[model samples]
Target: MPRSFDEILDQAAVPDTVTDADLDALKQEIVRDVTATLMFGARPAPEGRYPTTLDRAEAALTALCAELIHSTDAAEHLARIADLPIDADGALHFGCLLNLAQEPDGALWWWQFAAGAGNATAAYCLYLYHLFHGELRDADHWAHEALSLDTDIHLTSPAPCRRRKLDSPPEVLREAIERLKVDEVAGAQFHHPDHRLADQIEELADAC
Candidate 1:
């Protein structure tokens, strides 16, 4: 029992819905949620960057039209996020999430797509991925690519994750990424009235 009135207040009075064990559960949930945001949501890469949600359904549709050049068992995930409206920044972070899921092949596919869109941070990720896998030549190439793209700073970045934390990261990050897509669509609609995003997405699908 809380010995002090202040402690009870801080604990929210422990209503019927709040069981004795709920406090600890809530605390653990907070940690997991924060970790999910850091690992999958927008934060900063070592080089620097930052991070959204909705229109995930639409983004997934866009992704479906695209083809995966790599990825062992992540075609489903890839098909859920492609081209990533903001110059493939979504791709960059999704790659990190895929890495957390132990899908390096999937990560490479996304990183390459992002890199193709001139995402410098994705290039850096490619460099790191290749280096870790002992593919020095590819790593060197990606290092150069990252260096060349240094001036094109991005607002989103990737982070490292843990095995135990994987459970909540995907479900939580899915919502985050979906909301981001919604925001991206809103911004695009607001800024570029003439260029319908749906049409563009359709064209992208055709191009693919």
Candidate 2:
């Protein structure tokens, strides 16, 4: 008796907390913890080098994959969870792996898959990807999608707008701007064939 992907997704849609705000907060915390652990690795290591954190993160990500695999039957769910195309099914375990991937092509493939599957965090990540890669059209499209999903999750009030206003610190804003430029340049360098919309992405990224 295994659960279906639809079952898990429906369950995931329900707020486990008393309120939508609390549910949103929980999701954010989970993303923050997962991101921090996956990206920076664990802290407090020897001065010269520290690879244990990366190992630990990889292990944790593996566990997440195991959970998803054990819980669902939908092939798309597995594909989305791993961040690969419907057919590609790449071997990515953690969300942060997208950043560390050698080829942006592979990463973008997975992000697109996950975003299509209604993973809000994946949508946000895709937004970031387009933001960086100077794909203004896709960036705005994905950002709006993420915001819409967040709103749907809340069901009572608009949370994305409020969260954006509250989260906009000067440093974060500056970093976002820098990322936009880098993404634009990187997009042009790596994805020049699709660089027609880089200028548009640059403008939106700057405004953000």
Q: Pick the candidate with the highest lDDT.
A: 1
Give the per-residue lDDT digits (tens) of candidate 2, residues 22-119: 88988975664455445435342442575333333333332333333233232333334334334222222222232332234544655565567665
Clash count, predicted structure 1: 8
What local lDDT does model 1 show for residue 174? 37
Clashes of 2: 3
lDDT of 2: 0.41
List candidate 1 stretches off by more than 4 Å: 1-87, 151-208
Candidate 1: tens digits of C-alpha lDDT, residues 1-208: 5379887686886567777699998897566445534443632222233211112211221232122212232333333344333446556655655454344555577678789888887786776666444344686688789889886543222322211222333443333333332223322211111122222332322322
The lDDT, on a scale of 0 to 1, for candidate 1 is: 0.46
Task: Please tell me which predicted candidate would have the highest TM-score against the true structure.
Answer: 1
Model 2 root mean square deviation, Cα atoms: 22.1
